[model samples]
Target: MRNHGLVAFVITTAVLVPAAAHYLSAGHDQVVKFATATTSTLELAGAKIEARLEHPLVDPGESLRIKLVASSAVGKRLDVGLLVYGSKGDEDDRVPSPPVGVAHKTVSIAIDAEGNGSIEIAIPLAGAVENRYSPSPFTSYEVLVMAPRAATKLDRLRRNSALIGEGEGIPEYNASASKFMNLYSWRHDLQGEDATLFGEGVVARLDAHTRTINPAIAIETPSTTEVGKVFAVAVTVKNASRKPARGLVLDVETPIGVVDGAEGIEALVMPDNATFDLDAGESRRFQFRVMPDQVGVLGLYARVTCNGDDCDDDSALTKSGTFDATEIVKAQVVDEAPSIVGRK
Candidate 1:
C-alpha cells in the first residue's frame, strides 16, 4: 500500500495599508508622544491622537501600559473609551473582541495645562488561554482612543490627534513577526496535553502574499456510529470574502489515519478537481466515509487552502477534536464435523 501524504489546506490573508488620507479633521491639532523614544502621528476626525507605548511589545497575559495625552485649543471636558481590534491578515477587517482575541477598556482623563496631560491606561490580554493548544500566527492588533462627541471643534481636533497619534499612548499597531515568536507563550497552561510533550516552539511565519478575509473554518461529524461500520463525514466551507476564491482545496485529517478511497493520500493534493469558488457568505459541503479498522479512539481535523501553497502547518486555521470509539461485539469461528461421527 502506498503511504498517503496528509491532506492539509493553508489559507492566509494579506493586509495592505491603502494610500487614502488619514481619517482626521483638517483643522484639528494635537501632539502625542511614545514612551519608547520613537514618534509617530495619526489623524482621526481632523485631530491627531498622540500615543506612546511604555514598552515596545507585551507578552500575552501581561498588562500593556499606555500613556495618552490629548490637546485642543477648543478645550472642553469629554469622556473617552479605548478599544482594541485584531486581524489575521491585511484582507481581514478590524474585527471585534473574543473570537479575534481583541478587547476594550474605558478611562476618563482631563486635558490640563498646555492643552495636554497624560492618561495612563492598562489593557489586559484575554483569550491567552486558547493560544496554547492552538497557536495563531500572523496575529495583529490595533488600539484606538475614541473622541468625545460633545467637545467643541477645537477640542475634537485636539482629542482626535491625541488619541490617534503614533507616539507612546496612541494605538500602536504590531504583529508577531521576527521581533516576537509565539507571543502568547506566556499562557503555558493551554499549550498542549502536557507542556513537555509539545514544548514551546515559535509559530511558523505565514506567507505575506496571500490574503485572508474571514480567516476562519468549521467542521462537524455524526454524533453516533457503531463499531466496524462506515459513516459519512461532512465538511463545511465558508467564504468570508467579498470576492469569490478560485482553485480552493479543502483537506480533512482523521486520527484513525486516512480512510481508503479518500483523496489526497498519496500526495497532499486532493484527487478530484475538488476546486471551488465561493462568494461572500456562501457555504458548501463535502462528504467522505470513514470505516474504522478498530474501535478505541478517533478524531477529525479540517483545513481550507487557496492555491495549494497558502497555509500554516501548525496554526489552528486547521481544526481538530477527538471522539470515542468502542468495540461492542466479538467475532468467533464455529466447527462443523458432526456428520462424520453420526455415519460411524
Candidate 2:
C-alpha cells in the first residue's frame, strides 16, 4: 500500500488481494516517528488501553486474532473509539504496505472495569489461486488421492486425516507465505481529542507497531532425574500482555520420558494449571506434578493456550511466551526449549 506522503511498515508478507492496499488518510500530516517495536504501551483519555495479538498465525486465506482491552485508573470512566488495521509488509522488511483493505470490521469495547474484547482476522497475501503459496486452503493436504468407488468413504476419511502423512505442513506453509498480518490500531477519545505528545496539532494515533502483550513463562523441572522418581516443577506465567488474559491455560508438554504424576502420558490431567486467567501485569505460578518414568532428558516446555478444543488454526488464541519473540505469531513460532534460565 502506498501514498505519496504516507509512511508504511517494511514487513515480510504479501497481500493476496490487489485492492488490499489503499491510502491511510488519517490526517496525521506531520512526519512522526511511529514506534514499530511491538512491545510498548500507549495511554489515552484517562484510560490505559492496550492491543495484543495472540498469534499472527494463520492458514492461507485465514484470519489473525488481535486483543484490545481498556481500563481506567480509579475514578474516571471513559468511552473510546478504536480503529484496527491489518497489513502485510512490503517486499522490504522495514516498510509495510497498506492494510488488507477487505472491509475493516467495526467493534466497540467499553472501558470501565478492565473491559476486554478480541478479533480474529485474515491477513491478505499476494499469491495466485493455484499458486503454491495458497494451494488447497480447505484440504490442508498437499496430495489427495481418490480411491476406487467401493472404498470412497474410507479413503475420503483417511485422505483428510491430519495424521495421513503431513502432520501440519499445509497450514504452516500458508501462514508463512501470507504476511502474518501485522496489527496497527488507532484509538480515538470519544468525548474529546487530546494534545499530541509529539508537539504540534493533535491527531489520533495508531498503536506503535512495536507494542505487544505476551506471557513470560518460566518452567522449572529437574535437568536430570532417575526412573520412577516423583518430581515436581512449577510454571510461572506472567501476563505481559498489557491487558488481562482470560480463559488462559498453562499447557505443559512432557517429553517422551515423563508422564503426569496422576495420569499417564495420554491422560488429560485436570486441575493442574489447565485454567489460567490473568489481568495485565499479573503473574501466577502453578505446579506440574509429574513422574519421570524411563529416564532421559525430559525436555518439557510450557506453551499453547486455547479457549476451545482445537489448539492451532482454530484455537481462540496461541502465543509464544518469549522475550525476543518480537511478535506473537505462529509463522516462525518455535517454542522455547526448556532451560535453566536461572535457579527459579
Q: What's the TM-score of each model vs. the native? A: 0.30, 0.27
Question: Which ten-residue region of model 2 has the weakest summed lDDT?
Answer: 137-146
Predictions in order: lDDT: 0.37, 0.33
Candidate 1: worst 10 consecutive residues by lDDT?
26-35
Q: How many residue pairs clash in each candidate?
A: 38, 27
Winning candidate number (TM-score): 1
Candidate 1's TM-score reads: 0.30
Candidate 2's C-alpha runs over 4 A off are 1-215, 257-273, 308-317, 321-344
Q: Write the per-residue lDDT of candidate 2 for residues 278-321, one digit (tens) a residue.
A: 77787666654444433223334455465644234322234442
Name the TM-score of candidate 2: 0.27
